[model samples]
Target: MYYQCVKLRQIIIAVYLSISLDGVADSSGPYLASGIKIGEVDQTSAIVWVRLTHEKRAHFDKLPILTKGLKRNEKDAESMPEGVARGMAGEVRVGYVATNEKRAFAWTDWTQVLAENDFTHQFKLADLKSGASYSCIVQVREVGSDKLSSTTNGSFKTAPKKTQPVPIRFIVTTCQSVRSIDSGAQGHVAYKTMLELDPHFFVHTGDILYYDKAPLCKNIKQARAKWNLIFAYEHNMNFHRQVSSYFMKDDHDTLKNDCWPGQTYGDLTFDQGLKIFREQVPMGKKTYRTIRWGKHVQIWLTEHRDFRTSNRVEDGPEKTILGMEQKAWLMRTMKQSDATHKFLIVPGPIVGPDKRGKNDNHSNKGFSNEGQQLRNFLAKQKNTYVICGDRHWQYCSKDPQTGVLEMGCGPVNDQHMFGGAPKADKTYHRFFGKKGGFLAVTVVDGKAKAEWMSADVKGNTGKPEIRYTELLGSR
Candidate 1:
């Protein structure tokens, strides 16, 4: 009887805190705490992701490190740090206009951000002009109320028309672990240095965050908190606010290390992990896609975790990674493309001297059957190249047998560099770097050339040193 009475009192207090003295639902101002992400951009459309929070910025307090072997009892054992971005229920609307154009703003109806989706909403803006820069503003308000909360501004550049001969510059990076972050609240120095080059867009090839690492996330709530904690940093939020990006998922971000379709990380299922990824970022119906950036470049962004055979499965003809449908689409698209250069941006290496005994990606001996088949096709194509992520170190390699070229974009910071070749393998690697860095590619249509630069990350204020540069294709 005493326990029942206490439970009732707790419930009464919760209701009182949620409601006002006037008995109205408490509708307070919602702020843009996570900033905004613009992705899946093309000539005619782009998706803008937004989230409403209870505070102006994410809490900056640090979470306590977990004790060893205590995986499932984190919530009970230790309190979560205040550094998380607390989501709130609210409505969001977007308005956009082409940059430098004296035109009326195009607006969308207010859409509510729900708790089930981590208080996030993605607005798809269509009919945008090709090769044009767009200025966007997002407005937030309380649910069931007309009063405005605040407005945040962002910008992105649309891909040029298919036939237009335009030059393009973009950055590709991978394997950024929050635990490996060198800077505190400032986030990764790679973000600031990449921004300095003024890329048209950025591609995070995968391993955006480490879910299975220490302070393990074993459930949906904990997983969601992980996203809030990583993106809350000033550098991450500021970079995404300005640059349009393409986000991919690998084993770590999806669920666990080397995860497949049917696997589960604790109570978190594979399907739930997929849903969380889509909810957190701006994406379209299809995860695998090819976006054309004028006549010079066409980039194929492949999905790694969504469709694949189990890593534990025996290696054979039936052992596959890209799956049948995606493989078919990739082959068909490559055949029909007339672009000067074609880039297959994958979450893992295709021609890697990856650390031995690691059997997950195409680089491993386990997947050699399928890997060789894909490598053979790429070698025959005109000026085609594979730009990959997932490796901690950076390298440029050419398959000895197939003659196909590949560039591995290294980790975001120096602390994350590991498992790289101790000495450059003269047989495969034309260039290799054990330090942290990113890949910057420039495609010049008029000159009919592409420049690849592998840069080494210095400190936050220090300039990134260009370690290597290569002229790709017929220059």
Candidate 2:
């Protein structure tokens, strides 16, 4: 009797182990790479992006089996299980409609099959009405199946017509260190606060993710994996899902610190990094483009990496930062735009003096001539603002020469590297804080107001204590 009982116990343990292993496999199975994200909303169109995983499996019982009496390749007989069709990709459907209420959505009929294994898909919905709120939905159906495997919903408000005066608000942020996740920190309070504010959209100046620091990613695969890991965080996913994002890449996220084109870092080429960036971040075909938020704001998203001369090059009249073509495009765009607020977005501060000296790449000091050229051009414009990130600290300053307001948005979750030592110079340096937070800008009737909030090391954000209000002339 004792021997029989021990044998039965061993069988039960084996069965339990088998069930546990199966559960683990199921938990780690393929899933949506990231939740749906709304990117780049304009007066008439918006872009939606998502990634889905493809899997292949065969089940004979699930498919129709051939009869034993049937011969191979018989004309009148049904195909065998071996010849049964199975889906190898997923079908993505995106729908949107005008909505006055958030929950009461009316979906349109827009669907497409994801035939390629690219792992990323982008859909552009055009012909949308201006100054209207839209409710959008994204659904993924596995190939050969009629049921949707995953679904997510989001909403965006299109820019008003050119002559319309609409109140506009947006959050500007940068620099989320991957180390924050590794340290097992609590909820991202800064992100939570931004979500609570619920601005029209959010502009990510740059340094969206770090690859050169701890837990670094060396290759394309590793970089993609890092994106997945970061987005998997509950707060991060929730923020992207609910808010429209305009993303730009900086030194660390593109390749390494102070990186430019033509610099290769161990299996990570500029093109490869750019490809991954475009795939992951939903932006226009060109890295640099202009976004018009009605007649209130005209934002120029510049590309600092591509077409830039190496930072090591000597600063002179010929040393170009914006490159010839981009500079011309920017000038043309700025000169033609009649918006109340013209925001020039860069990855780093263009007017401040860096701690390292006057020639560091972080600030525009290194490219003095090009920087001066930009300043001269801005001097002619009206209410032109330069918004930047990468300083890991917040500052509200103005270019002494051109009087253009320069606002440096602090880091989102990383440590403030600058110790707030270099005092304010001749330039307009109003406030500087070494805290992790973001900038909230509100534009109404051609006037703009900016508030800088502080986020503690623990990620808890305080109210907007530092404020900069300016009267940007009439539209």
Give the runs in model 1 whose Cα sits over 4 Å from its true position. Answer: 1-28, 64-83, 418-422, 446-462
What's model 2's lDDT at 147? 56
lDDT of 2: 0.66
Look at candidate 1 and give me any clashing residue pairs.
59-83
Compose the digit string of candidate 1's lDDT tens values, residues 386-407.
9989988878888898888898
Q: In model 1, which range of ten residues has the least summed lDDT?
A: 66-75
Clashes (N, CA, C under 3 Å) per candidate: 1, 0
TM-score of 2: 0.79
lDDT of each residue in 194-277, candidate 2, tens digit only: 766657778888777766654456776656655644554456665776667899888878888888888776677877777878
lDDT of 1 at 384: 93
Identify the candidate with maximal lDDT: 1
In model 2, how large is the Cα lDDT of residue 141?
63
